[model samples]
Target: MRWAACAAGVGLALVPMTGSAQAQEELEEVQEARRTLLMAMPGTPVSSIWGLVGQLGIGVEHAVGSYVALVGSVQVSGALQGTESLLPGGSGSSGQTWGVGVDPGVHFYLTGRAPEGLWVGPHLELATYHWTVQNEYLMGRPDVPLSEGDLVTVETRSRTVQYGGSVRVGYTAILAPGLTFQVGAGLTALSSRNTNFGTPRVEGGGAATDVEGQQLLGSGFGPNNIRNWSVSPRMTLGVGWAF
Candidate 1:
Protein backbone atom coordinates (compact mmCIF):
# COMPACT_ATOMS: atom_id res chain seq x y z
CA MET A 1 0.00 0.00 0.00
CA ARG A 2 2.86 2.41 0.79
CA TRP A 3 4.51 1.70 -2.58
CA ALA A 4 1.22 2.31 -4.43
CA ALA A 5 0.71 5.61 -2.53
CA CYS A 6 4.25 6.76 -3.40
CA ALA A 7 3.58 5.98 -7.05
CA ALA A 8 0.43 8.13 -6.95
CA GLY A 9 2.37 11.00 -5.35
CA VAL A 10 4.97 10.90 -8.14
CA GLY A 11 2.29 10.98 -10.84
CA LEU A 12 0.57 13.96 -9.19
CA ALA A 13 3.81 15.93 -8.92
CA LEU A 14 4.67 15.29 -12.60
CA VAL A 15 1.18 16.38 -13.75
CA PRO A 16 1.77 20.00 -12.59
CA MET A 17 5.28 20.08 -14.08
CA THR A 18 4.01 18.89 -17.45
CA GLY A 19 1.26 21.48 -17.46
CA SER A 20 3.72 24.26 -16.60
CA ALA A 21 6.06 23.14 -19.38
CA GLN A 22 3.24 23.15 -21.94
CA ALA A 23 2.28 26.70 -20.96
CA GLN A 24 5.84 27.91 -21.38
CA GLU A 25 6.08 26.35 -24.85
CA GLU A 26 2.90 28.11 -25.96
CA LEU A 27 4.21 31.48 -24.75
CA GLU A 28 7.43 31.03 -26.69
CA GLU A 29 5.52 30.20 -29.84
CA VAL A 30 3.55 33.44 -29.52
CA GLN A 31 6.75 35.43 -29.09
CA GLU A 32 8.21 34.00 -32.29
CA ALA A 33 5.39 35.51 -34.40
CA ARG A 34 6.35 38.97 -35.55
CA ARG A 35 3.80 41.78 -35.35
CA THR A 36 5.60 44.91 -36.58
CA LEU A 37 8.04 45.94 -39.30
CA LEU A 38 10.25 48.92 -40.19
CA MET A 39 11.05 49.48 -43.84
CA ALA A 40 13.27 51.49 -46.22
CA MET A 41 12.09 52.13 -49.76
CA PRO A 42 14.20 52.19 -52.94
CA GLY A 43 11.40 53.86 -54.82
CA THR A 44 13.28 57.06 -55.58
CA PRO A 45 16.09 55.46 -57.54
CA VAL A 46 13.72 53.32 -59.57
CA SER A 47 11.43 56.20 -60.37
CA SER A 48 14.34 58.38 -61.41
CA ILE A 49 15.47 55.71 -63.81
CA TRP A 50 12.01 55.58 -65.32
CA GLY A 51 11.89 59.39 -65.63
CA LEU A 52 8.91 59.53 -63.32
CA VAL A 53 8.28 61.42 -60.09
CA GLY A 54 10.04 59.77 -57.17
CA GLN A 55 10.03 59.91 -53.40
CA LEU A 56 12.41 59.08 -50.55
CA GLY A 57 10.70 57.75 -47.49
CA ILE A 58 10.53 55.52 -44.43
CA GLY A 59 7.57 53.27 -43.66
CA VAL A 60 6.12 51.08 -40.95
CA GLU A 61 3.63 48.24 -40.71
CA HIS A 62 1.88 47.00 -37.58
CA ALA A 63 -0.47 44.07 -37.23
CA VAL A 64 -3.54 45.23 -35.37
CA GLY A 65 -5.43 41.96 -35.51
CA SER A 66 -5.10 38.43 -36.78
CA TYR A 67 -5.91 39.44 -40.35
CA VAL A 68 -5.39 43.18 -40.50
CA ALA A 69 -2.40 45.49 -40.46
CA LEU A 70 -1.96 49.25 -40.60
CA VAL A 71 0.77 50.82 -42.72
CA GLY A 72 2.03 54.40 -43.10
CA SER A 73 4.88 56.43 -44.58
CA VAL A 74 6.26 59.95 -44.92
CA GLN A 75 8.06 61.13 -48.04
CA VAL A 76 9.88 64.10 -49.61
CA SER A 77 10.50 64.78 -53.29
CA GLY A 78 12.11 67.41 -55.53
CA ALA A 79 12.95 68.26 -59.16
CA LEU A 80 15.10 70.81 -61.04
CA GLN A 81 14.43 72.52 -64.36
CA GLY A 82 16.56 74.48 -66.87
CA THR A 83 15.56 75.68 -70.32
CA GLU A 84 16.72 78.12 -73.03
CA SER A 85 14.37 80.95 -73.96
CA LEU A 86 12.21 80.42 -77.04
CA LEU A 87 13.16 83.82 -78.51
CA PRO A 88 16.48 84.93 -79.99
CA GLY A 89 18.85 86.79 -77.57
CA GLY A 90 16.75 85.49 -74.63
CA SER A 91 19.26 84.40 -72.00
CA GLY A 92 17.51 81.39 -70.33
CA SER A 93 15.36 80.24 -67.43
CA SER A 94 15.79 78.05 -64.35
CA GLY A 95 13.41 76.58 -61.77
CA GLN A 96 13.53 74.93 -58.35
CA THR A 97 10.76 72.64 -57.09
CA TRP A 98 10.09 70.67 -53.92
CA GLY A 99 7.28 68.68 -52.33
CA VAL A 100 6.26 66.65 -49.26
CA GLY A 101 3.68 63.91 -48.83
CA VAL A 102 2.14 61.28 -46.58
CA ASP A 103 0.58 57.91 -47.26
CA PRO A 104 -1.55 55.67 -45.00
CA GLY A 105 -3.29 52.38 -45.60
CA VAL A 106 -4.75 49.16 -44.19
CA HIS A 107 -3.85 45.66 -45.27
CA PHE A 108 -6.19 42.66 -45.36
CA TYR A 109 -4.31 39.38 -45.44
CA LEU A 110 -5.77 36.63 -47.56
CA THR A 111 -3.53 33.61 -47.10
CA GLY A 112 -1.98 34.24 -43.71
CA ARG A 113 -2.10 36.42 -40.63
CA ALA A 114 -1.44 40.18 -40.61
CA PRO A 115 1.94 41.43 -42.03
CA GLU A 116 2.50 38.20 -43.93
CA GLY A 117 1.61 36.37 -47.14
CA LEU A 118 -0.60 37.94 -49.82
CA TRP A 119 -2.59 41.09 -49.07
CA VAL A 120 -4.77 43.73 -50.67
CA GLY A 121 -5.54 47.19 -49.42
CA PRO A 122 -6.60 50.75 -50.13
CA HIS A 123 -4.34 53.71 -49.40
CA LEU A 124 -4.76 57.50 -49.29
CA GLU A 125 -2.20 60.19 -50.09
CA LEU A 126 -1.81 63.90 -49.47
CA ALA A 127 0.93 66.07 -50.93
CA THR A 128 1.90 69.69 -51.53
CA TYR A 129 4.54 71.30 -53.78
CA HIS A 130 6.14 74.67 -54.44
CA TRP A 131 7.83 75.86 -57.62
CA THR A 132 9.85 78.95 -58.51
CA VAL A 133 11.07 80.09 -61.94
CA GLN A 134 13.62 82.73 -62.72
CA ASN A 135 14.19 84.11 -66.21
CA GLU A 136 16.22 86.88 -67.94
CA TYR A 137 15.41 88.62 -71.23
CA LEU A 138 17.44 90.88 -73.51
CA MET A 139 15.20 93.89 -74.31
CA GLY A 140 17.60 96.16 -76.26
CA ARG A 141 18.20 96.07 -80.02
CA PRO A 142 21.38 94.18 -80.94
CA ASP A 143 22.51 96.96 -83.33
CA VAL A 144 21.94 99.79 -80.79
CA PRO A 145 23.72 100.66 -77.55
CA LEU A 146 22.43 98.96 -74.45
CA SER A 147 21.05 100.62 -71.29
CA GLU A 148 21.03 99.47 -67.64
CA GLY A 149 17.28 98.58 -67.84
CA ASP A 150 17.75 96.80 -71.21
CA LEU A 151 17.97 93.46 -69.41
CA VAL A 152 14.80 92.46 -67.56
CA THR A 153 14.44 89.81 -64.85
CA VAL A 154 11.20 88.01 -64.09
CA GLU A 155 10.24 85.55 -61.34
CA THR A 156 7.20 83.31 -61.11
CA ARG A 157 6.03 81.19 -58.18
CA SER A 158 3.22 78.72 -57.66
CA ARG A 159 1.90 76.15 -55.17
CA THR A 160 0.02 72.93 -55.77
CA VAL A 161 -1.99 70.58 -53.55
CA GLN A 162 -2.79 66.99 -54.48
CA TYR A 163 -5.03 64.35 -52.91
CA GLY A 164 -5.43 60.80 -54.10
CA GLY A 165 -6.00 57.13 -53.36
CA SER A 166 -4.95 53.77 -54.68
CA VAL A 167 -5.85 50.08 -54.53
CA ARG A 168 -2.90 47.72 -54.20
CA VAL A 169 -2.11 44.02 -54.14
CA GLY A 170 1.14 42.65 -52.80
CA TYR A 171 3.11 39.87 -51.16
CA THR A 172 5.40 40.07 -48.16
CA ALA A 173 8.04 37.42 -47.50
CA ILE A 174 9.86 36.86 -44.25
CA LEU A 175 13.28 35.86 -45.52
CA ALA A 176 14.63 35.17 -42.04
CA PRO A 177 13.64 35.54 -38.41
CA GLY A 178 13.62 39.34 -38.54
CA LEU A 179 14.16 40.19 -42.20
CA THR A 180 11.34 40.86 -44.65
CA PHE A 181 10.96 41.90 -48.28
CA GLN A 182 7.84 43.12 -50.04
CA VAL A 183 6.60 44.00 -53.53
CA GLY A 184 3.37 45.63 -54.62
CA ALA A 185 1.53 46.98 -57.65
CA GLY A 186 -1.41 49.32 -57.83
CA LEU A 187 -3.41 51.95 -59.75
CA THR A 188 -3.56 55.45 -58.41
CA ALA A 189 -5.95 58.31 -59.12
CA LEU A 190 -5.14 61.85 -58.13
CA SER A 191 -6.67 65.33 -58.28
CA SER A 192 -4.65 68.50 -57.88
CA ARG A 193 -5.25 72.26 -57.71
CA ASN A 194 -2.56 74.78 -58.49
CA THR A 195 -2.42 78.46 -57.57
CA ASN A 196 -0.10 80.88 -59.33
CA PHE A 197 1.31 83.86 -57.44
CA GLY A 198 2.73 87.16 -58.71
CA THR A 199 2.23 88.80 -62.09
CA PRO A 200 4.72 88.33 -64.90
CA ARG A 201 5.88 91.36 -66.93
CA VAL A 202 7.87 91.46 -70.15
CA GLU A 203 10.09 94.16 -71.64
CA GLY A 204 7.15 96.02 -73.18
CA GLY A 205 5.62 96.61 -69.71
CA GLY A 206 2.68 94.36 -70.72
CA ALA A 207 1.49 91.65 -68.36
CA ALA A 208 1.74 88.07 -69.65
CA THR A 209 -0.80 85.31 -69.13
CA ASP A 210 0.27 82.49 -66.83
CA VAL A 211 0.08 80.05 -69.74
CA GLU A 212 2.18 82.30 -71.98
CA GLY A 213 4.76 82.85 -69.26
CA GLN A 214 5.00 79.14 -68.65
CA GLN A 215 5.45 78.51 -72.35
CA LEU A 216 7.98 81.26 -73.00
CA LEU A 217 10.04 80.30 -69.98
CA GLY A 218 9.62 76.59 -70.61
CA SER A 219 6.68 74.33 -71.20
CA GLY A 220 5.54 72.81 -67.92
CA PHE A 221 8.07 74.98 -66.13
CA GLY A 222 5.83 75.80 -63.18
CA PRO A 223 2.40 75.03 -61.78
CA ASN A 224 -0.63 76.88 -63.12
CA ASN A 225 -4.02 77.81 -61.67
CA ILE A 226 -5.81 74.78 -63.01
CA ARG A 227 -7.42 71.66 -61.56
CA ASN A 228 -6.18 68.41 -63.03
CA TRP A 229 -7.11 64.74 -62.65
CA SER A 230 -4.90 61.85 -63.60
CA VAL A 231 -4.61 58.07 -63.25
CA SER A 232 -1.41 56.05 -63.28
CA PRO A 233 0.16 52.75 -62.32
CA ARG A 234 2.44 52.44 -59.29
CA MET A 235 4.97 49.83 -58.23
CA THR A 236 6.74 49.46 -54.88
CA LEU A 237 9.59 47.41 -53.43
CA GLY A 238 10.84 47.50 -49.87
CA VAL A 239 13.11 45.66 -47.43
CA GLY A 240 12.47 45.73 -43.72
CA TRP A 241 13.06 44.28 -40.27
CA ALA A 242 10.26 42.59 -38.38
CA PHE A 243 9.80 42.47 -34.61
Candidate 2:
Protein backbone atom coordinates (compact mmCIF):
# COMPACT_ATOMS: atom_id res chain seq x y z
CA MET A 1 0.00 0.00 0.00
CA ARG A 2 2.76 2.44 0.87
CA TRP A 3 4.53 1.52 -2.36
CA ALA A 4 1.32 2.36 -4.24
CA ALA A 5 1.28 5.84 -2.70
CA CYS A 6 4.90 6.40 -3.67
CA ALA A 7 4.16 5.29 -7.23
CA ALA A 8 1.22 7.73 -7.42
CA GLY A 9 3.46 10.57 -6.24
CA VAL A 10 6.08 9.67 -8.81
CA GLY A 11 3.42 9.55 -11.56
CA LEU A 12 2.20 13.05 -10.58
CA ALA A 13 5.75 14.34 -10.78
CA LEU A 14 6.03 12.90 -14.31
CA VAL A 15 2.70 14.49 -15.39
CA PRO A 16 4.55 17.82 -15.71
CA MET A 17 7.77 16.11 -16.92
CA THR A 18 8.74 14.31 -20.11
CA GLY A 19 10.35 11.03 -18.94
CA SER A 20 7.84 8.24 -18.15
CA ALA A 21 10.79 5.87 -17.98
CA GLN A 22 12.33 7.70 -15.02
CA ALA A 23 9.03 7.74 -13.05
CA GLN A 24 8.58 3.99 -13.59
CA GLU A 25 12.16 3.33 -12.38
CA GLU A 26 11.46 5.17 -9.06
CA LEU A 27 8.24 3.19 -8.60
CA GLU A 28 10.11 -0.07 -9.11
CA GLU A 29 12.58 0.86 -6.35
CA VAL A 30 9.74 1.59 -3.92
CA GLN A 31 8.07 -1.72 -4.77
CA GLU A 32 11.28 -3.62 -4.16
CA ALA A 33 11.66 -1.97 -0.70
CA ARG A 34 8.09 -2.85 0.20
CA ARG A 35 8.46 -6.48 -0.91
CA THR A 36 11.63 -6.92 1.19
CA LEU A 37 10.01 -5.33 4.23
CA LEU A 38 6.95 -7.57 3.96
CA MET A 39 9.06 -10.73 3.58
CA ALA A 40 10.94 -10.22 6.85
CA MET A 41 10.09 -12.91 9.41
CA PRO A 42 10.62 -13.11 13.12
CA GLY A 43 14.28 -13.99 13.88
CA THR A 44 13.83 -15.07 17.52
CA PRO A 45 14.28 -18.79 18.27
CA VAL A 46 11.72 -19.99 20.84
CA SER A 47 13.36 -21.46 23.91
CA SER A 48 12.48 -22.35 27.53
CA ILE A 49 15.83 -23.08 29.12
CA TRP A 50 15.50 -23.91 32.85
CA GLY A 51 12.13 -22.25 32.84
CA LEU A 52 12.82 -18.52 32.64
CA VAL A 53 9.77 -17.79 34.77
CA GLY A 54 9.40 -18.55 38.49
CA GLN A 55 6.70 -20.92 39.81
CA LEU A 56 5.41 -22.38 43.06
CA GLY A 57 4.52 -26.04 43.58
CA ILE A 58 3.72 -28.21 46.57
CA GLY A 59 3.87 -31.99 46.78
CA VAL A 60 1.15 -33.57 48.88
CA GLU A 61 1.80 -37.02 50.37
CA HIS A 62 4.76 -37.28 48.00
CA ALA A 63 8.33 -38.52 48.33
CA VAL A 64 10.83 -35.78 49.11
CA GLY A 65 14.61 -35.83 49.27
CA SER A 66 17.85 -34.02 48.59
CA TYR A 67 19.36 -34.68 45.21
CA VAL A 68 22.83 -33.64 46.31
CA ALA A 69 24.34 -33.69 49.78
CA LEU A 70 24.46 -30.32 51.44
CA VAL A 71 28.19 -30.01 50.91
CA GLY A 72 29.71 -27.24 53.02
CA SER A 73 33.07 -25.84 54.08
CA VAL A 74 33.80 -23.47 56.92
CA GLN A 75 36.70 -21.22 58.00
CA VAL A 76 38.34 -20.58 61.41
CA SER A 77 39.23 -16.94 61.76
CA GLY A 78 38.70 -16.19 65.44
CA ALA A 79 40.12 -18.98 67.64
CA LEU A 80 41.58 -21.46 65.13
CA GLN A 81 43.05 -19.62 62.14
CA GLY A 82 43.38 -21.80 59.03
CA THR A 83 41.85 -21.19 55.63
CA GLU A 84 41.83 -24.93 54.92
CA SER A 85 43.47 -28.16 56.01
CA LEU A 86 46.59 -29.23 54.17
CA LEU A 87 45.97 -32.29 52.07
CA PRO A 88 47.29 -35.24 54.09
CA GLY A 89 51.07 -35.00 54.15
CA GLY A 90 51.00 -31.23 53.84
CA SER A 91 50.08 -31.43 50.16
CA GLY A 92 47.28 -28.92 50.69
CA SER A 93 44.88 -27.84 53.39
CA SER A 94 41.33 -26.58 53.50
CA GLY A 95 39.12 -25.39 56.32
CA GLN A 96 36.27 -27.84 55.71
CA THR A 97 34.69 -30.17 53.14
CA TRP A 98 31.37 -32.06 52.78
CA GLY A 99 30.38 -35.28 51.09
CA VAL A 100 27.19 -36.86 49.80
CA GLY A 101 24.80 -38.79 52.00
CA VAL A 102 23.23 -42.06 50.89
CA ASP A 103 20.00 -41.89 52.85
CA PRO A 104 16.80 -42.07 50.78
CA GLY A 105 13.95 -40.67 52.84
CA VAL A 106 10.44 -39.31 52.29
CA HIS A 107 8.15 -36.81 53.90
CA PHE A 108 4.53 -35.64 53.75
CA TYR A 109 3.16 -32.22 52.92
CA LEU A 110 1.38 -30.43 55.72
CA THR A 111 -0.14 -27.62 53.72
CA GLY A 112 -3.73 -29.00 53.59
CA ARG A 113 -4.33 -27.54 50.15
CA ALA A 114 -1.73 -26.29 47.63
CA PRO A 115 0.10 -24.79 50.58
CA GLU A 116 1.01 -21.80 48.44
CA GLY A 117 3.28 -23.94 46.31
CA LEU A 118 5.11 -25.31 49.32
CA TRP A 119 5.27 -28.68 51.11
CA VAL A 120 5.22 -27.47 54.65
CA GLY A 121 5.62 -30.79 56.43
CA PRO A 122 8.22 -32.98 58.08
CA HIS A 123 11.12 -34.95 56.50
CA LEU A 124 12.51 -38.13 58.00
CA GLU A 125 15.93 -38.95 56.61
CA LEU A 126 17.53 -42.30 57.37
CA ALA A 127 21.19 -41.44 57.83
CA THR A 128 23.61 -38.76 56.79
CA TYR A 129 26.66 -40.17 55.01
CA HIS A 130 29.61 -37.97 54.14
CA TRP A 131 32.70 -38.22 51.96
CA THR A 132 36.10 -39.00 53.34
CA VAL A 133 39.47 -37.30 52.85
CA GLN A 134 42.37 -39.08 54.44
CA ASN A 135 46.10 -39.45 53.89
CA GLU A 136 49.05 -40.91 55.82
CA TYR A 137 52.51 -39.57 56.51
CA LEU A 138 55.65 -40.67 58.36
CA MET A 139 57.13 -38.84 61.29
CA GLY A 140 60.70 -37.56 61.91
CA ARG A 141 62.48 -38.41 58.62
CA PRO A 142 61.65 -41.01 55.99
CA ASP A 143 65.32 -41.50 55.08
CA VAL A 144 66.60 -41.70 58.64
CA PRO A 145 66.33 -45.10 60.36
CA LEU A 146 63.48 -45.32 62.89
CA SER A 147 62.80 -41.85 61.50
CA GLU A 148 60.15 -41.53 58.86
CA GLY A 149 59.39 -38.20 57.13
CA ASP A 150 57.84 -37.44 60.53
CA LEU A 151 54.86 -36.86 58.29
CA VAL A 152 51.29 -37.31 59.50
CA THR A 153 48.29 -37.36 57.23
CA VAL A 154 44.71 -36.42 58.07
CA GLU A 155 41.60 -38.53 57.64
CA THR A 156 38.20 -36.88 57.53
CA ARG A 157 34.90 -38.70 57.17
CA SER A 158 31.45 -38.79 58.73
CA ARG A 159 28.19 -40.81 58.75
CA THR A 160 25.17 -40.41 60.97
CA VAL A 161 21.90 -42.30 61.43
CA GLN A 162 19.50 -39.60 62.43
CA TYR A 163 16.00 -38.43 61.58
CA GLY A 164 15.11 -34.80 60.96
CA GLY A 165 12.34 -32.65 59.54
CA SER A 166 11.97 -29.24 57.98
CA VAL A 167 9.29 -27.06 56.49
CA ARG A 168 9.83 -26.88 52.72
CA VAL A 169 8.40 -24.24 50.34
CA GLY A 170 8.95 -24.42 46.64
CA TYR A 171 7.46 -22.74 43.58
CA THR A 172 6.41 -24.54 40.42
CA ALA A 173 5.76 -23.03 36.99
CA ILE A 174 3.70 -24.72 34.33
CA LEU A 175 5.94 -24.61 31.30
CA ALA A 176 3.65 -26.62 29.07
CA PRO A 177 0.25 -28.10 30.04
CA GLY A 178 1.08 -30.98 32.35
CA LEU A 179 4.84 -30.41 32.37
CA THR A 180 6.05 -28.12 35.13
CA PHE A 181 9.39 -26.65 36.22
CA GLN A 182 10.08 -25.89 39.87
CA VAL A 183 12.65 -24.39 42.22
CA GLY A 184 12.55 -24.41 46.00
CA ALA A 185 14.48 -22.80 48.85
CA GLY A 186 13.98 -23.71 52.49
CA LEU A 187 15.58 -24.24 55.94
CA THR A 188 15.88 -27.50 57.86
CA ALA A 189 15.50 -27.72 61.61
CA LEU A 190 17.20 -31.03 62.06
CA SER A 191 16.87 -32.99 65.29
CA SER A 192 20.22 -34.64 64.77
CA ARG A 193 23.11 -32.29 64.09
CA ASN A 194 24.99 -33.19 60.93
CA THR A 195 28.66 -32.42 60.52
CA ASN A 196 29.76 -30.50 57.43
CA PHE A 197 33.40 -30.73 58.58
CA GLY A 198 35.24 -32.81 61.11
CA THR A 199 38.37 -32.47 63.19
CA PRO A 200 41.63 -33.21 61.45
CA ARG A 201 43.11 -36.64 62.24
CA VAL A 202 46.88 -36.48 62.31
CA GLU A 203 48.73 -39.80 62.45
CA GLY A 204 52.32 -41.07 62.15
CA GLY A 205 55.32 -39.51 63.83
CA GLY A 206 58.99 -40.27 64.49
CA ALA A 207 60.09 -43.01 66.94
CA ALA A 208 60.18 -40.30 69.56
CA THR A 209 56.69 -38.94 68.89
CA ASP A 210 53.80 -40.63 67.07
CA VAL A 211 50.95 -38.33 66.13
CA GLU A 212 47.70 -40.22 66.62
CA GLY A 213 44.20 -39.21 65.48
CA GLN A 214 43.67 -37.72 68.92
CA GLN A 215 46.57 -35.31 68.44
CA LEU A 216 45.12 -33.93 65.23
CA LEU A 217 41.60 -33.77 66.65
CA GLY A 218 41.20 -30.05 67.02
CA SER A 219 38.46 -28.23 68.91
CA GLY A 220 35.98 -28.54 66.07
CA PHE A 221 36.57 -31.57 63.88
CA GLY A 222 36.71 -34.77 65.89
CA PRO A 223 36.52 -38.51 65.41
CA ASN A 224 33.05 -39.88 64.59
CA ASN A 225 30.66 -37.05 65.42
CA ILE A 226 27.24 -35.60 64.59
CA ARG A 227 26.64 -31.95 63.68
CA ASN A 228 23.69 -29.67 64.24
CA TRP A 229 22.08 -26.16 64.08
CA SER A 230 23.52 -25.92 60.57
CA VAL A 231 21.80 -23.43 58.27
CA SER A 232 21.64 -25.00 54.82
CA PRO A 233 20.58 -22.69 51.97
CA ARG A 234 19.11 -25.09 49.42
CA MET A 235 18.00 -24.76 45.78
CA THR A 236 15.87 -27.24 43.85
CA LEU A 237 15.41 -27.70 40.07
CA GLY A 238 13.46 -30.45 38.43
CA VAL A 239 10.53 -31.24 36.12
CA GLY A 240 7.22 -32.42 37.55
CA TRP A 241 4.20 -34.10 36.03
CA ALA A 242 1.09 -32.52 37.51
CA PHE A 243 -1.97 -34.73 37.39
Best by TM-score: 1
lDDT of 1 by residue, 1-243 (tens): 999999999999999999999999986575447888789875432122114556788889999997899999877888786777565555677777778888899999997777888999999988887777777755444465434224555777777888999999999887656788988999989898888877764443234333344455565345557798888897878888988
Off by over 4 Å in 2: 1-122, 125-127, 135-148, 154-156, 193-227, 230-235, 240-243
- The superposed Cα distance between candidate 1 and the true structure at residue 204, in angstroms, equals 13
lDDT of 1 at 129: 76
Give the per-residue lDDT digits (tens) of candidate 2, residues 1-243: 999999999989977675677788885554333210001111111111111212232232222222211111111111111333344444333322222222122323333223113343333333332345555544444457433245656666544333454444555443323454544556554445445455555655544455343454554354454544444544444554533
Worst 10 residues of 1 by lDDT: 42-51
Best by lDDT: 1
Candidate 1 residue-wise lDDT at 26: 84
User: How many steric clashes does model 2 contain?
Assistant: 30
Task: Note the Cα lDDT for every prediction shown.
Answer: 0.75, 0.38
